[model samples]
Target: MKKIIILLLIITKISLAFEDCIDFFKKERYLQAKQCFSQINQTDPLYPYALYYLLRTRVYAEEDYSDLLPEMEKFKNTAVYSYFYLYLASINRFKNPKLALEYWSKIDKEALFKDDIPFYYYLKYQIDKSLKKDPIKEAKKISLYFPYDRFYGYPVVFENINILSEEEKFNVLDRLAAKRMFTKAIYLLPYIKDGQKKYLYSALLYMKNREYQKAEYFISLLKGKYRASAVYSYIFFQRKMSEKKKYFKELLKYNDKKLIWKAANYLMKKSFYLQKYKDFFYYSQFIPEKSRYYSNKLWFLSLYYYIHGKKNKAAEILEKNIRYFSEKPKVYYWLYLSYKDINRTKAYKYLKKAASIKKIDFYVIRAREKLGLPLFEGKPMFLKFYQSKTLDMIAKLKPIDYKAAYIEARYFMKKHGVESIAAVFPELAARKLSDRKYLVRYAYPKPFLKYATDNLTYAIMRRESFFDPYVVSFANAVGLMQIIPPTARWIAQQKKDRNFDIVQLFEPSKNIEYGRWYLKYLDRMFKGNIFYIAGGYNGGDGTVRRTLKRYEIKNIEEFVELLPYRETRYYVKYVYTNYKAYQTIYGRK
Candidate 1:
């Protein structure tokens, strides 16, 4: 009995010693943990953890590249990491890159950790490249996902072609042409058989190479099948009008309203005086309900009456057309003239309406001066919508300058009704009153600042450009909110400003004005779905649309999680980071 009791005591002592070592290791006392792990030779899960630390400490302690290899191997075999990349990528294997490549080759390239895939594929590609005897063939092995390879001179053409068709295909084809690879792309069209697609590509190719006859030939072939398509017919008409007046005159025989309109325009251009006015009426009556040509037709019709010296008749046409077209600049231009000639009061009313909306368009300016309309100098148009939870989240993640936080708070209070802004009001006041005179320092608009109290947006701003107004991203976006040039120009056009140049978009007032409009536009494009809108803003509207349709995202959060673009994924993270930082500093509503 005494011998058995002594044995139990000895067992208990050893067990306690092991537990003590684990405790020390948990405390990160690596040297002590290493010794304890060595004492046990049974090879347990804890064995790996201890060994990983042992190698890591050895590498740190000795700073020897030679020792790094074996230690890495042992550690990989022992320790459990989140990805266990160290196990697969142990430095000891570097001496035999062939063996290392062989080992890495066996790894499921598609089953990599989310952040590690790009690097993994890049590494594999590098290895394959190193081993390749034929550099030309190896060069073609590059990932189909990325564009811009002057070496191969391949953009996303081959990859994009496999999936898109019709209008979508044409969009891609245009992009390919923009890259100056249209002639090369012609050879690729043989793999596709859609008639419209074939005709379109053929026409583009012929047009670029100055083969007008071939272009006409290809377009004629498509007319029988795609005659109902106004756009296609219109395209054909334009080409034919330039090259063959006889054929252009023959095309007017078609009874289709859009085609008739095209014919009438052609007749008018060719000085067919007897038939021009009659054909114009036929064309005018056939304009589609949603036709972009409606305003132009109204203007032309009203002008015809005015030039024929039918004053009352012209006024009636102007009134009817103005009501039909709403505030369109073209209609307004004619109406302003009609009203000035007939009744100054009516002219002033319509001109004021046009000027108040915008005074920069050609027609609007004419109307404004004729009626002596007041300038639209009131407080700027703005938008508001922010959730506290969303704002709080932003504050935790984003970085916001002093004045930005203040302005964002004000916006939340006014637009989103986020009561959280009150808590941070003092900070906002301090910053606004600060003596700092730097450009863009205190230049943040009140509404924009308030809206930006979002956590992610503020955090993202820091990493994006340190809030520099002039920072232009690789994608050609500028200003604090990073508005794209094309998008800015579009917004300016919508607001009736023809002079809004894309180059001057970095100006603070212009940048924010257009940036907010773009955000709103994106929001609308995604159906007020913030996640998709955010993704759309970062990746592309088309990409976000495709992804949403691909994943069939019914919920914004799920869509965000499923985004294929890592840039978009990180952008979401960064936007929320900015929002969180804003919420934190501003003390969320």
Candidate 2:
């Protein structure tokens, strides 16, 4: 009994120590994390994780390369061996190209971690370029297939593609234009042989730079169908229309499927802005059946019909098209509301159907409330280790061995519905498998809560950036709370924190601090209304205020459904949903 008690105490200490080490690593305090990792007992279950962190710590710190080769050699037979060698190769790429190339060739590309995949391709491009190999082919491959956005801006391959034939160059330029890399496309315009493509891109380039006169010069160069294209009409739409009849005639002449789709999408927003529901419904029909926006068009058009006292028409359209939408609970709820005046039986049937669905979306919650159903609960699952060859291997070797095996088995497991063996790795499982438990503990760490001037701050953090301290949005909103630089500066000024720098926003504690302050500020401005606070947080305060003034909002949900910007509308729903979920989970209500 005494021996068992001693064992339990030791295990407790190790678990707590490992947690602290992981926390340090996540916060980017590499040196502290390394020190914490170094203190773990070699016999502990997490000893392998400590070693992995120690190696990563050295790499992150830019320490001497001498220890790297020796350390990598020591772990050459381990599961993460490729990861180690790849790190060494990446750091040595420019400094010692020969040695880097050798290591790169030795490392197994398929064994790389998810974060390292993109970097591997990036290094491949750089190394092949240095070796005078066909770097263009490598770059093209990466640019076409890499799943993530470029961390280092556009790859150097674009510059080298200039040496290819004019037609090939034009194809590449066209791809760049489609991706909205306007500057890059313009830079390669001299290499395009096609006069029309050149003129179009030149006009786009000048328009992007806000040089309207120069843009008009290139626009004048377009003739015939190109003149009636969406491109010319778009420019005219931005400028004053001296002759409305002529403008509408040319704009309505867009027979190109792509242009018609674009014009219809634009008109949806324009008609809404002008409060012309009839015109909005007219343009919505032109949206292609295959377009991603088609379902949105259906929902809004049905909504217009319902608002204009055409309930039968709304029900007809919704019944015909509800299957196209992925948000079934929301669609069913809308169907229920639409049928209330027409068929009482169908209304209750759809209401009960929507309530029974398990999704945690806004409509699911509302449907449950209407039917007196309980809130959705996520029960944690556990699987005990079994007596198998795989388990035997995992028991005798490093946890990373199990991690590598699990990664390789993902497709098999996914297809066969076998449980993820990733949960078998103690360190990795602690981060990924537990869902809400780990998310709350790591993301909404208790230390940060003391800084919250508003209780909803942590909930907002989850919705904003999912507590990823390194996250950055397309709009350049950085860190956990997704605060843009200007907002961070404003918060700093309000607090008289003159020493606060923008880079500090990446710290979880600091981000939560600033975020809470902003939330409190918004609360005061919005007069403690959570819906308005959430809306103002996602869409600007000015936009929310203008929207409120523009419409008679008898129902918040209805108003949200009609929001002009799709993202902002969803943002309000997501933020509030997250807030409610948090309240329900923690018994905070």
Candidate 3:
């Protein structure tokens, strides 16, 4: 009895000391963290973690960690050892290229964390270049894996541009344009041919950068279909009514269905807003029935006729196109609304069709509410059995290394998306866990439940980072809530938090708190409208205000459909759906 008690006490002490070291590390008290980590005995199960963090502490403190390399290597074949090798290689890449190569050779490239693969290729290219070896292979690898990586990918590809194929060069250009790296992309254009493509890219780059005059210079140089498309885009951005109408009229001469659909859609919306029924009808004819925008075109046309006291025409349009949108609940719901007073039997038929689709979305929710049905069907009976079986399988298989699973899961989620979590734990797949409740719980985890329980918070976090607190976006938005550094700093100042560092935004607790505060700030700015609040969170308050002021937003659905920014439109839909899903799953509605 005494022996067991003594062992328990020793384990407890080790756990507490290790946690203190972690706390010190998180607080950036590197010296204290180093000392605490060093005190951990090698016999403890956390010894590997202590050694790893001790090395990390030195690195974070900007101190030489060459001495820790020998100690780190003692845990050969371990995840911590692999990470240390990569870190040392990265830090030594410039200072001691040969030594960096030596460390790099020790890493198993295939076993590397997905995020680390880009850096691994980067270090390989650097080593190849230093040794005067052929680096084209490494450069191609970098370009293929991380084409938009400004720091590593751009440099390698640019340096090796002379040897690259035309296709590879164009790939780099496409990625650069997509990422808005116009300056670097411009330098590559002089070397590549294809005048039409180049002019279009240049015009698009300037246009997207909001330099309308610069875009027009390139647009003037373009001709034929390219000119028509560029002019349409330029007018769309420039918002000159005369130029818009001129280019939109010219666009109809081209046989391109995409451009025609775009022109017609814009004109249709404009005509609807202006109450020009004849013009609206003319433009609506150009919208191809096969285009993706056709359903939206139908919805707007139906809405226009309905509001203009032509209810029968509205129902007729929806019924004519109902086959194309059989799976879309919004169309069904809208059709129901059109027939509610005109034809009660038809209205209930469409309502039942919308509500019985077995999907959870805005329209489905509205349809269910109209029928007084439960928002969520009750949890499936198989979910409990599946959970039990998954636990048993995990215990039996022991497929995942729990010690390293969290870090691996974060990287996996970032690379493959949250739906791919089951890949990290084979037991989940082996048990064939297909319960919607479990899947939703995994994808939209509420790790910061202690900070906030409102569905909005989790919904935002799920959309932003899928609960990966260390994830950083291309815009430099850090952590679970994807708060940019400037915004986080401003939020900190607003709360009078003197010691708040931007680095703290990577911490889940601080990120969630700051994000929640920003949401409340948006709530006040947008009068607690979830659509505007969500749109403001993603597209900024100015964008939300401009959209609300510019459009005749009669309701939430129309506002979402008419949001100027496609990203914001999808963002609002996703976040709102997430909010509704959370409410349904947690019984909060």
Candidate 4:
């Protein structure tokens, strides 16, 4: 027993030391991390990890890691051998391309870290090019899997684009546009030979970037059905009501089903917003029953008629089209609301059906609230003793082989954050585990609890970056809380923090601090309305205030649905759902 106690103490000490060194590495204090790593005794179980990170720290610091290559053979029998091989390949790539290729050839590509996969392909492309071999496949993989890898991917794609097929090129262009890398898309435009495709993409890119005049120029250069599509898009971005109505009506005359659908969808929403029942019904007919928005059209028509003192007509519309909705919690809730006034028995039936839906969503929660049922039904006790199967498996390895894998998993979690552990261990990705204790905890982690422990804080964090402290969004929002640099800087000034830098926003504590401060400020501005707070967080507070004044918000549900910005509307719903989920899971309520 005494011997076991001593061993446990030694293990605890090693774990603490390894975690401390990892903290230094995460903070980019390479020298300190290296020193910390160097201090671990060779006999310790964690020594292999310490040595590996010591070499990694050197690579990150851009210092000479060649001397450490001889020491890296120690990693061959360890779990981190794949990473060492990757780093080894990266180090020798430019100096001795053959040696890098040799090292890379020994690695199990499947074991490469998620973030490193792009770089691996990148190196393969470079080596293939250096050897005068066709690198089309590697280039395509980088473009498809990691186009946002600005260092290697974008540069490689721009250089080798001529070799890609037209379909592949269009795919790359579409991905770049989706990632909002419009500058790269614009740069590639000169390479596209097809005039129609080029013109359409150019207009779309310019419109996405909000360069309306440039977009209009490109749209003018277009012709035929494509030009009509472009005009509809251009009109969609403009605020002129007369122009929207005119072109949308003109769009209805075109035989292009997609453009007709888009025009009709827009006009339906607009007419509903303006209470033009005639125009709303006119446009609603153009919406195909096959369209996903068809149900939304039905809902809007029902609401319009219901509000205009036609309750029986509203019930008939909902009952007739109820089969169209695959996810019917919201539809059922709406039916309950519509029927409660005229027929309580029918209302109760619909309310019970909505509350009984297995899925938990905004409407489901509201229905449960009305029925006095538990908002969520799950085993919260599962979290109390939760332990990841991957870590447990690692712990069962031979003592000499255990710590490296353990540290590897922990380091991956630290770097990538949240569900990234599953990325490292594919077994964790099983759908069966989604509702299990581990995944539930993973889906709703409570990081930075000391800074702010509220359900809303965790909800926002889950939605913002999924607890990824180093994540930078397309809009340049940083860290777990997704605080923009300008907002973070302003927050620093408000707090009188003299030494604060925008880079600190990538630190979890500081990001959460600034984000929570901003949330509190919004709370005060909006007088504690969560819907407005969430909308303000995504859209601006001014937009939320204007929306509240523009629409007579009867309730939170109506306000969320009516939010003009689709992103903000969804953002509000997601944050609220996350908040409620957290509350339910943790028994906070």
Writing each residue's lDDT as its tens digit, candidate 1 over 345-409 gives: 77767666665554224344444545675322223212233345424422421232322233334
Better of 1 and 4 by lDDT: 4
Per-residue accuracy of model 4 over 464-498 as CA lDDT, tens digit each: 87665667888888987898888888888999999
User: lDDT of all the models against the reference?
Assistant: 0.50, 0.65, 0.73, 0.74
For residue 166, give model 1's deviation from the true position in Å. 11
Query: 1-589, model 3: which lDDT tens digit per residue?
Result: 9999999977855665666887888899888898788888776555666777888888887877667767767765444566778877887877888988898888866546656678889988988788778888988878755766767777777677777777777778777776667677777877777687678877877877777788879888898888877876765666665666776777777677787788778777777655567877888888877877787688888877766668789999999988676447888887787888899999999999888877656677778878998755544332212232222322322222332545543333344443454543432232233333222444444545567888999888877877666778878789889999999989989999999999888676789999999999999988889889999999899888876786656667767765656678789987987787777667573
Q: Give me the displacement of residue 18 in model 3, in angstroms.
A: 2.6
lDDT (0-100) at residue 530 of candidate 2? 80
Model 4: weakest 10-residue lDDT segment is: 424-433
| The best candidate in terms of lDDT | 4
Q: 22-86, model 2: which lDDT tens digit per residue?
A: 77888999988877877877566445446667778877887644543554464443345666667
Supply candidate 1's per-residue lDDT for 360. Answer: 25
Worst lDDT window (10 residues) for model 3?
Answer: 382-391
The C-alpha RMSD of each candidate to the native structure, in angstroms, is 19.4, 8.4, 6.5, 6.7
Error of 3 at 107 (Å): 2.8
Error of 1 at 469 (Å): 12
Q: Each model's TM-score? A: 0.38, 0.67, 0.77, 0.78
* Deviation of model 1 at 310, angstroms: 4.8
